[model samples]
Target chain A: MEVLVTRQINKYFYEPEKFQVLKEINLTVNRGEFLSLVGKSGCGKSTLMYVLSTMDTDYEGQLEIAGQKLTGKKQDELSAFRNEHIGFVFQFHYLLPEFTVLQNVMMPALKQSKYAREDIRDKAMHRLKTLGVEEHAHKPSNKLSGGQQQRVAIARALINDPDIIMCDEPTGNLDTYNTHLVFDIFRQLTSESNQTIITVTHDDEFASKTDRIVQMSDGRVVV
Target chain B: MAGNRFQLTFEIAKVHLLSKPKQTIIAMLGVTFGIAMFIALVGLMTGLNDFTEDITMTSAPDIHIYKDITKPRQSILQQIYPNDMVWVYHQKPKNELTKVRNAKKIIELIRKNELVRGVAPALSSQVFCNYGPVQLNGYILGVDIMEEDKLFGIKSKMKEGRIEELLANREGIIMGKGLAQKLDTKKGDRVVITTPEGYTMTLKIVGIFQMGIGVIDNVRCYANIGTVQTILQQDPSYITDINIKLTDRHLAKKIAAELEAKFDTKAEDWETANATFLTGVIIRNIITYAVSVTLLIVAGFGIYNILNMTIYNKMKDIAILKAMGFAGGDVKSIFMIQSLIIGVIGAMAGLLIGYGLSVLISKTPFNGGDIISLDHFPVNFDLKFYMIGVVFGVITTAVAGYMPSRKASKIDPIEILRGQ
Candidate 1:
């Protein structure tokens, strides 16, 4: 159940003589497999993640997510697939500041799915309750505690029930206790659904929990 | 695919107020204020224009065929036709000269034409009315009540006595309010009227009126056409001006053209009467557009400020949404919806405030008869104003949203994710 595969993926930033971010990258992630890509700063792992997400298509790449080819697709088709199949959790939660915690979870629902109001509402409440932050559902994202906010972010990522949840440093800004709390939530999510999880991290402790480890140095995958 | 995305977009936009209702409200206030000013100013313009046209339509008959003195002289090629000159006979009262003038029946022959609705002979006398030491130099007119009313719209605008009331007696006269005041005369007041010949005749002021215009109110008196006909001692068939009435006002120029063709002379409509009125209409339109554009700029700035801030704060979200499989166009639409939300709120606020302001202005006071009048500035917020508001509102908001939407669209997802 290989969920994602990449062959000869190459991402270039500007002139190759000056700044080239990725070159000849190759990787694959299996279904229900928790994978982590560990790298130093400026190693272009984030650039690779963006290409994987279909956010930047300027790179030369043969990329597939859930066995569907991801290249040269219309912007709309890519958005639809991303909304329906892939969940994203950034280093910063990046939840709309104006929206409540429930609204943050419901953001994907509103963005992609055409469920009735009650369906999205029910799902949002359930996700918030599951994440044990139903109390923060009415509160704005910025109002929540650091650990609570990261949990809320995880809830948002899961609301769409996406096949793959890709997190870029989910606890990059949190304290050690909050970091462990967020990682524990991530472990809980993958164990419950056997969902595919891809995390890009600089921390070995966080990366060691993953089922597979891919190391990157400079612009290419080293191991 | 179902387009509930718009509802989603709108929901997001609406909650903008929830996040920062104060700022949103401040922005909307700009909208409300802009629209209110627009409505009030345009309403007053409409009211004034309506008032002017009303005065013209009520005081002057629908089709007045005065000469076009201001017209550019006919090109030599255009003047090939004979210049037809129709004699306008003025009347003389109690004199055989009128009868003798009426005796010649050739010019009266045009009365046979069915297009001629009425053929009234009129007389005018300019004399200094000595009303108990208030010597007011004013005009006095005499006309056939039935025929004159159809020509000058006299009976229709009468505030006091009926035109028939003036026609019944030889000495009956109607005076305007200002004139009535100057003469110390009212309804049923007896005033001595003297001709330019110094022949004094005591006449009863049977009516007093006001036409809402001061110039007309200050110096106007009318009596039966035949009465002045006898007094002027002119030809009976002669009217100083043959005031023509027509079936359609828009066809006035056509009728004048036909008359010019048939009579071999020139004719003009009220549009060309003063020449300055047309210029005034153009200037007023320019003023309306100028004011509306200025308000639109102010509104655009308000929306621009909000939208620009929106994109800056949502930079990471821009990256996230883009990463979530949203296109550059989608991101633009999201920001665009925000500006459009402002537009909707602003436009609605404008309409509400505009209506209130219009009503408020209708009751506003000013220096009487100095600029326009001391009365409520006439305001008619017609359909045109709303059409203007809608067009400019959408355009301005879309434009204001453009910079931010494009910036959002151009976000490099990698840089944003890396927190750069």
Candidate 2:
């Protein structure tokens, strides 16, 4: 089943001058597929990822995610939709530094407001245990090392059991060991739970290990 | 689910505020002092107003009934020489004064009313006091002694001799301290009193008192009504004014209106008698509110500045929260909750501080006869003042918070992430 589709997507930036940054892009991703978006810097890979994640609504495009048309939706509706069906991980592991790891993991589910708080807490603990960070669940996020923080971020992304997990450089700041560990976790999530993932990364080795890689150059997908 | 969302928002707001203790404390202090000043100053002003009303109402009757004095008829010469033309003419004898008639009947009618606590008929006349080759002119208020004393608390104000002495001897009079000094007379001294009608009589001074008002001490005296009427060669029933005390002083205006409509006479209540003082009270209140509200708004600006800086510093965090599926309203509510917490705590502290200050001021003595005539600074401990302070503080902080929250809500997540 196709989980996301983007057709004729175009984006422009008018900083010093008006210029097209994303040109007539077309893409689709199937459920349970672990895909990676790889490109050089300034190749519009991050821009396309942001547009697909429903974070950038300014692009002229049609975006359908999880069988719902998302284009032309109001900001609040998009926010609710994203809360229910999408999860995000960033390069910096954007966990609230003041919150415990467990609390940070439960943030998205709490915002969804569909489950009781105790149930959300139990699910959060379970996700942390799966990521092998349950021992540090009560510790503040800032107390953890870089690799541990990235793992916590991944746990947070899976807390809501979302249809799609969108990530920007999931292992960009990790060492080789942590990179392989994160890749193995993604593989297990795709094969066992059939969680769809779309990630943008600069690491060619990590992309090669994924199910498939979409390469981009100068705002167009080259392969 | 509803409870969970608020808890989430409150948790985030609490973390943000606690992380920057110095700025949050500064913002709280702004609201604190603003509310303190408002409560204290308003309390003091209200106390002063109450004090003034108490003094005036104690000294004067709640309502005074009298016939309206008619203006002198336009002179025939003024009729002929109109439009700013000046013409000199020989002065003619003045017409008879308009005196309140049927005084006995009116007094009887007023005394029968349930609202009337007491009614006293008073006849006042301008007179001259002569002794030892010195003649000083003054006004004499003729009263039934007991009734007038009850109406104006004159018995309590007597400084020398007894009010009953005036009632015992029809020829005895009570003169002001300064008037007695000017006449160089003491109690039991005889002074020749001459009315405006040129009738003279000898009267003994039985009492002397000082009313604290310079003009009243200098020119006022009291005598029996029969003596004054005999000196002026008027009938016993003639009286210039009727002073009526009411069951409730606040009902004076309403009673005065009814009396005026029923009796075809002008009635003056204490509120109308002290119009200038009432106007002063109203103007003072206006200035107090204006100054306090302005200061509070300035305090609100201090809160705004702090929150605005916090929002700017937290832009990256806000972007990530939005990317995590937190709605814009949720983001805005987090900041608003922080402001509300600060407002509530600050206002409570301010009320305590302001109340302590007011009590301290009320305890400090005036020591000397200051302009306000109060022995100490009057401070009212009305609960409404505290309520006003808390409400004002909360509203100010909320408004201050709203602007920065709106700015936080409008930030584009993608733009912030890109910048990062």
Candidate 3:
């Protein structure tokens, strides 16, 4: 089944002047597919990623995710949809520094509130263990190394068992070793468990190793 | 599911507040002192009100029954003989004293009422107290000593001499210690009273009392009802006033109205008799609350500034919270809960502090010769004052927290993440 489909997407930035950022962009991703969007800086890849994740509702488009039309939804409804179906990994890790790694991972699950607290805790621990950060679960996120924090952030993204994980330069702030380690985790997640991932990246090697790469120059996508 | 969401939100708020311990403490203390001052000031104001009520009520009867000053007979005569030209020209004296007839029957009727605690008949007349060359104008109230003592607590106020001696000796009188000082007389000395009806009599001073009220102490004297009636050249049974005490003093007004309607006489309760004094107390009460609430709101502003700064600094975390699927409303409640926690803790601390301060003030003694001499300063520690403080504190804190929380909630995640 198609997990995400965007039709005739158009976005603009009104600052300085009415400037078109993305024009007539169209894309689709299949279930369990691992795709990378590769582009140079200021090529609208991050903007497309934000639009696809339902975080940027200013664009004019038809966006259907997980078989549900998400266009023109209220912010709360979109938030609930993101909580249940879509997870995000940002470049800076964005783990709440005041919380323990386990707590940070459990935040989205707690927000979902579909399961008991104990069940959420157990699931959060399982995700931490899967990411090889369970031993550091009780430590505050700010106390972790750069690589460890990124791994914990990825674990947090997966705690809700979301269908699609959208990462905006997830490994952008990491060393090559941690970058490859995150790449390996994403590859294993898709191949072993059918958890789809769409990542926007500037790393040429990272894009080359993905199942498929959609390269962009200016605002047009070229396979 | 909704309940679980609130738990998560509270956890986040708790962590955020704890992360900045100093700011949170400052906010809590602002509310604390605000509430403490509210309780303390209200306590003192109400305490003074109670004290004034006690002093006024203790010295005077709960209800005073006197003859209604009758209007001139011309109006009634004209109504009976309307358009009679000769009656319209006939007018009676306006300043004539209207005496209460059948005083014995009215006293007997009031004494039988279940609510009535004491009833005493008194004959009051303005007289001149003369001690050789020193002459002072005063009013003499003639009373049955025992009944007056039960109603007015007069025996306890005696500075010298005995009130019962007035009953034994018809020529004896009890005067205020201040009046005795002004008249240059003492207990067992002779003083002359010249009545308005031109009857002069010499009376031996039997009791000297001090009520600590300047006017009453300086110009009031008491004598036997029969002696006062004889000196004023009136019937032995004729009395100008009937003073009453009730089981419940607060019910005096209602009962006084009833007595006025039933007996066709003027009845005045302590509330109406001291209307000006009560009005002053009420105004003080209003001023107290106004000042207290203003102080509390000022403290609320301090909380607002602190929370505003915290939210500004935590913009990134707020954006991340939203991106993690917490709705704007959820984020707003998280900050509100933090303020509520601060308010509740501050209120509790403030109540304790206020109570301690009140007890401390109550222990401090006021020396004699001050405005009103008392063994200690009066500070009422009423629970209602503390309750007002807590409620005011929480409301002010919530108002203060609202604006900053709204700013935090509206933070756009895309905007913050785009900074990367």
lDDT of each: 0.73, 0.88, 0.88
Q: Any runs in candidate 2 off by more than 4 Å, and if so which?
A: A14-16, B62-70, B76-98, B109-118, B126-139, B153-166, B169-221, B230-234, B245-272, B367-373
Name the candidate, 1 or 2, with the larger lDDT value: 2
Residue B213 accuracy (lDDT) in model 3: 74
Best candidate per TM-score, number? 3
Q: Which rank order by TM-score, best down to worst?
A: 3, 2, 1
Tens-digit per-residue lDDT, B175-278, candidate 1: 87778877777788777666787766667887776776777778878877666666665545644544555555566666666755655434455666645865
Candidates ranked, most accurate by lDDT first: 3, 2, 1
How well does candidate 3 score on lDDT at residue B220?
A: 89
| All candidates: TM-score | 0.85, 0.87, 0.89
The most accurate candidate by lDDT is 3
* Residue-pair clash count for candidate 2: 0
The two-chain DockQ for each candidate, comma-separated, is: 0.59, 0.68, 0.70
User: How do the residues B170-257 of candidate 3 rate in per-residue lDDT, one tens digit apiece?
Assistant: 9999998778998889899999999877789999999898886767888889999989988988877779999999999999999999
Lowest summed-lDDT stretch of 10 residues in model 2 chain B? Answer: B366-375
Query: Could you tell me which 10 consecutive residues in candidate 3 chain B have the lowest summed lDDT?
Result: B366-375
Question: Residue A168, candidate 1: how far off, in angstroms?
Answer: 1.6
Model 2's alpha-carbon lDDT is 0.88
lDDT of 3 by residue, A87-205 (tens): 88999988899999999999999999999999999999999898998999999999999999989988888989898999999889999899999999999999999989999999999
